[model samples]
Target chain A: MNEQSITLKKKPNLGRRIGDEIKRNFVLYLMAIPVIVYFVVFVYLPMYGLIIAFKDYRPFNRMGQGGIWGSPWADYYGFGNFVKFFQSPLFWSVIKNTIYISLLGTCFSFPAPIIFALMLNEIKNLKYKKIIQTITYLPHFISMVVICSMIIRFFQTEGILTKLITLLGGEKQNYMINEDAYRPIFVGSGIWQGVGWGSIIYISALSSIDQELYEAAVIDGAGKWKQLVHITIPGILSTIVILLIMNIGSILSVGYEKTILLQNDKTASVARVISSYTYDLSFGEGNSDFAYSSAIGIFQSVVNIIFLTIANTISKKVTDSGLF
Target chain B: MVYKPSIGEKVFNLFNILFMALMIFICFYPFWYCVTCSLSKQADTASLMLLPNGFTLATYKDVLAREAIQKGYLVTIFVVVVGTIINLIMTTIAAFLLTRKNFAIRGFLTWMMLFTMYFGGGMIPTYIVYTQILGLEGSILVLLIPGCISVYNMIVMRTNFNGIPTSLEESVKVDGGNDMHVLWHIIIPLSKAVISVMVLFYGVGHWNSWFNASLYLQGTEIQPLQLRLREILILGQTAAEGDAGDVSTMAENIKYATIIVATLPILLVYPVIQKYFVKGVMIGAVKG
Candidate 1:
């Protein structure tokens, strides 16, 4: 044990004494310089500016805001913006809409790719499979603005979808302008755009399963369904769990940029999310409400963090897979 | 022997086929409708029916003829090329450096990258930093600079680099190769899969990006294609439906055409590079 400990201690020294590792690896460091400077300039340095959330910030009065620390602290107000946001009537409704939309998206859209991957797995014809995959994946690359535009055109009263709805004996109501239709449209479109591309990950996971397991199952008189349930799912569980945890972590972020692009005043009641609301507050032609928006943003981030931590903890306890 | 299905299994199969058909139709119909509608006459477009009332390229012609859109196309192309190059350089180098285990400060460096993943300074401050501090407010650099290194891309590339067999490195060193030579000669060649992954991801991201340009450029001349197309879509819809009356009917047809021009190139190019995309995503997702 003493000799082993001495060898372990000497090991690090041997590696270090090899040279001025930086000098030897100077090219690597040189390669890394731009990336390092980039992160510092773009990510870290701006992080110092998060302090503006605590300040009475105006773009023109930026220097006079006493540069964050010197500004009047939020301590005196005791989460005043937080309280104001909570007290606002839009808070609960927006929160409800967000949860409803995200949850609906999660329930419907999340498993869509998995189901897609499973189905694609069942398809033995490789050429047809490739063609289907290619066609379906196209939407994921389409710009949101264009996607939204296509959606708008397709749902118009005279549009094909609307005509089909009429043919199917449904009302020809213009759903795009309806507040109640927001969730369905958002979730529906999200699934359409995402499902095919999302399956790419799971398909890879499914592919990684040992071929012998399937062959053995087949030899054991097991069917495709049984093999899938017992072997395939279990093989992909850890990947699924990790992905699920990451999804849970970002539950608060409902891809709001797309949501914003899709939203109209009619849909805004049901569609406005924390991110969109913050966007409005920041860029809305009214008062420069930076503090309020930041406060809400901070609150949203806190909730996301809390949910992420709880999810990690619960996943670790239940399934032994988590981000941390 | 016939593969006879029991009633339950028959129902299951029916349900599966129905669901699959429904999903494919839902996924595909909107784009089909959009393309057909854009090609249709104004009367047909207004009717908005399944099939075109009459086919015409009038809208495409009108949209293509616009000076603003032509300029927007130029700007967008410029931004995408510059942005993707910057992203590749920054992310690939960072990935390379982080793969070296004995870098002495690897953990610290990694922690620095990871720290940015969870925390951000929010918009206003970042806006200030770029506009006020960097003086890139109205410049095209604003679009290119702020997002040079996506942490996600960096992590993916790092993992890819790490996976390259260490034996290759040893063999290179036996030939008396330096770090740069090894990286350029061996590591990069081996990393084509991941590098291509970054290229597609970063390229698509840059191509589709508009919010940064919207926020920063403020100049009509420098605005990207997506921004221009988005504005056209919004303006066209408003003019057609709303009482906002300064715009002409010609603008409506132009807007429809603008949508086609903005999207068609990417749609055309996607199928070409899509195989590489799938490969990249598969490789990244496995280790991701």
Candidate 2:
């Protein structure tokens, strides 16, 4: 009955071992039931519905009997939806728009946070640092809806942003209504919203660097800038790489909600990305092509998976740290 | 601490301080503008300005009196409070159970949860599931049920639970207490920081969520604050009745008022829990 006997005793078979585990942890399994049910219903069941992409789906088709739950994927329209998407005139623009916005966002947003963290680390006064940090981080906690609202309020025709542009000898149109201005506005607002909060991890990483490294550098007559370039960046390099990989992983999956709120007919040409395209196609005027839009969604998810895996692998090779 | 003055270092320090102050100004200026715009006289608010001119509470009074804004506030408060509670309970129970060493098929269960994180059925397919299968579309339950237990939060809570020493639970067991007693008496008490973090995350998520409601629900009555704010601010709808120019100016100011009213609830409480969120991120970054 003691520890020696428990270790010295013959091991049980796999089935017996599992049975014993269940018997011993019945309460835990009972607790897990609801979570298991939630995933099954919400997550797994919907994943199964992704197959509607391959079928000729109609909305009011028999719910479970002859529609999605049936063997609809074996028909002639197996790849018709995908073919139609590939052949569509909107295809190239959607791809270009999504990538353009995402890459622009990543280019600025990914580095802005790192630089913000580095700058914050340089501050000597704790009160000033705390004040600056709180002010910067406040915008992050503000809802995206509020953030978008603020953006629109600033960019209206007679709004402050427009007035400033007119004063500076630029055109006086609302930036939101300008098609060419879409990427800059979207990416700029994205950085303004996320840069402060994104710096959280890097700041946390900065705190973990061994103090002795800085002390040694100081004794060696290295300037603060040199010490920063050497000790600080290297200390946070792995975090940067890991975060970069994640940022790249989400390149295709950048937010659609913000675009949905911001995109009007004037800017839709530049602002219409893959997710929004899918949303529009599914619910827009005469857009009952559920199957077709579902195909687009599948295209996005596949590309996202590929991008994530590639970035993760590159991260593992370069830094020995990856998201996996 | 006693060192000779270096002019370059002093210059660098001055520059850093100025740049940081600029950063703070950039982040905070928009909110400041929103407040000042809401309070400024409608005509004065039309021009580009830093500070409020001819200040009045008319816009705030006007926006708040609207039935739409009131409904939005009520729905948001209900969803945030109720959804966060449901989220915390479900997440804690799931995390606690998953962290148990004796739980069978643990790896499979973990994989099931994590799989959803990487790949998901996109909007149309998920919309079908919600509308056709679950009958959640157009219902308030769409907001409440689908995201009752966020997978990311579950992972964080589970990681936190795993960090706790098993001896605490064992001691409760030794005292002839059941798993529920151990969870209530030990795990819940010990995981307060992480629990609070999860609460804050879920609260903010629910409060700011307009996308799902916008997609699912058809009516404005059950919509949350963010949705109403979205319509007023982004959709460029006028909230007041008047002549074209007069109402448009009032609408712009009223939109700013709505922004302040919508954001102030969360903004007011952020400072107190700021440290907890930073701590949460630090802990999550270590393992996640």
Candidate 3:
């Protein structure tokens, strides 16, 4: 009887247990059905549409003129659009502009939050800290459209901000018209808008730092600065590294919408990244080149993926923290 | 908590206080200016800045009177409520399934969700699928269905589920309870904190999202509050040709008021659900 039971138990091991688990969690599986269907229909199915990137995709004769699958000369056009993109006079400039803006934005915006969080953590008066945090967080929820509009208004000629700058002995310049000022305006505004809200995560990480460590540092006659440097900084190092890695991964995406919104005739040259270019080509009077635009979008996404992977690998090697 | 500061520390504290105060003012000033501008007299408002010389609720009344804005508000509210409910249900079930030690395909299912984060068919393709393939364009289903299960949120919910002690599941199994019974009776009750976090995430996402609406409902009256506000604020400013009384001035107060209106619900709900958001983001950031 014991031998028979042992053989039966072995039969119901791992794989069989999984099967039974699936059966038991039938209700849960039912709940997941809609989501599964969603991705399969919207995401997986459309990946096939990427073939249009290779083809001379026409809206009217989608199926006969060259379906994504059976298009004539579509395969030959392989890398044709890519070659055109690379050979275009704007290509190198596009890459340069994207990297420059993203890096500048990240460099300014990322550290602002950490500094804000540290300063907030140092505050003894709870009410004042709360007020500061509340005010700071409010800007984040404002619609990007509204934010962009406000930026336009505040930087325009005779605006209050301009008046203030003039009073401070600076010439009342149309800062928005200058290409050199674009990076500063974008990065500065991003940091100002996001620092408080972004700092909330770091503040949480700070709170999680063991209270005993600070006490121990105090007993060792460590000053407030020393405690913050040795105890607090070390405590939140991993969160910092993880966030840094994630930020580095998307270094090419300069958020085209805001740039497009903020763009004018003068700033367009400096502001136009792959995203804005693709958008202009697809929708704007430039080309209305949908297939070309899609190809560019793919190219941008591929570059981002590569950057992210490299960043992740580097983080794993150096800091032992990665988003894998 | 009643720690005293040294003289040097006090000076530093004072500096910090001033800096924080300055930061707060810098942040709040734009909204304040916008409010002032909107309320000011139209032509007179062109050069006006800082505080409003003449405060009026005229712009607020005008915005509220617009049928488009009103409809947008209703649509946004409906989408948020329904979308969050769907998110909570789907995520809760998935989280419940993940907690089962005997669940064999758990890792596979988890990775399936995560795959979406790295790779997605870009917007155009996704739009084609929704419009041509799914035939759900201009429908309410478009808003709730396309982004129903965010992989990041799913992973967070699953991680929270994993933190629930394994004994909770085993004890229920010991009583011969089936999976559904245990999920409803035990897991649902226990996972309230994470559920609320997921709700806030979904709610805020739905409230803020206008891109999808702009894409899918091209000609329909399916404008959500954000979309309507966006059309006025973004599209208004960029292509300001039809009107001439300083488009910026016209938008000033109404823009701030609309922003306040759009964001106030979440702000009100936030404090009640603040602890969950704090805990969720903290844990998610660390684990992530």
Instruction: Name the top TM-score candidate.
Output: 2
lDDT of 3 by residue, B1-288 (tens): 445667988888889989998999888877666666666654232353676667777777877787887899899989999988987876676666566665656676667667777787776655555655568888988888776777777778878877777687778879988777777777778888888788877887788787778767877988888778777766666555335445645545566566555655766775566556666777677676
Per-model TM values vs. the true structure: 0.89, 0.93, 0.88
lDDT over C-alpha atoms for residue B118 of model 2: 72
True-vs-predicted CA distance for residue A106, candidate 2, Å: 2.4
List where candidate 2 sits over 4 angstroms from the true fold: A1-20, A62-66, A74-77, A315-321, B1-5, B46-51, B237-250
Q: Rate the local accuracy (lDDT) of all candidates.
A: 0.77, 0.82, 0.75
Question: Who is ahead in TM-score, 1 or 3?
Answer: 1
The digit string of per-residue lDDT tens for model 3 on A39-69 reads: 6776678776676667665554634553445
Native contacts recovered, in order, as a fraction for each? 0.50, 0.77, 0.41
Q: Ten residues in a row with the worst lDDT in model 2 chain A?
A: A58-67
Error of 2 at B245 (Å): 8.0
In model 3, residue pairs whose N, Cα or C atoms come closer than 3 Å (at least 3 residues apart or on different chains), thus clashing, are: B38-B253
How much is B261 displaced in model 3, in angstroms? 4.4
Query: Candidate 3 at residue B173, lDDT?
Result: 77
| For model 2 chain B, the run of ten residues with the poorest summed lDDT | B237-246
TM-score of 1: 0.89
**B130-215 per-residue lDDT for model 1 (tens digits):** 76566787888887878788888888888888888988988888999877777888889998888887888888888788887877
User: Candidate 1, residues A1-324: lDDT per residue as tens digits?
Assistant: 999988777646645655667777777677767777888888877677676666665455645644444556564454766877889989998788778877897789888898888877766667867877888898999888888876776576655567767878978866677777678888998888999999998888898899999878877877667888999999888878887887887777777668767777677898898888888887766756766777788888888889889989999999988888
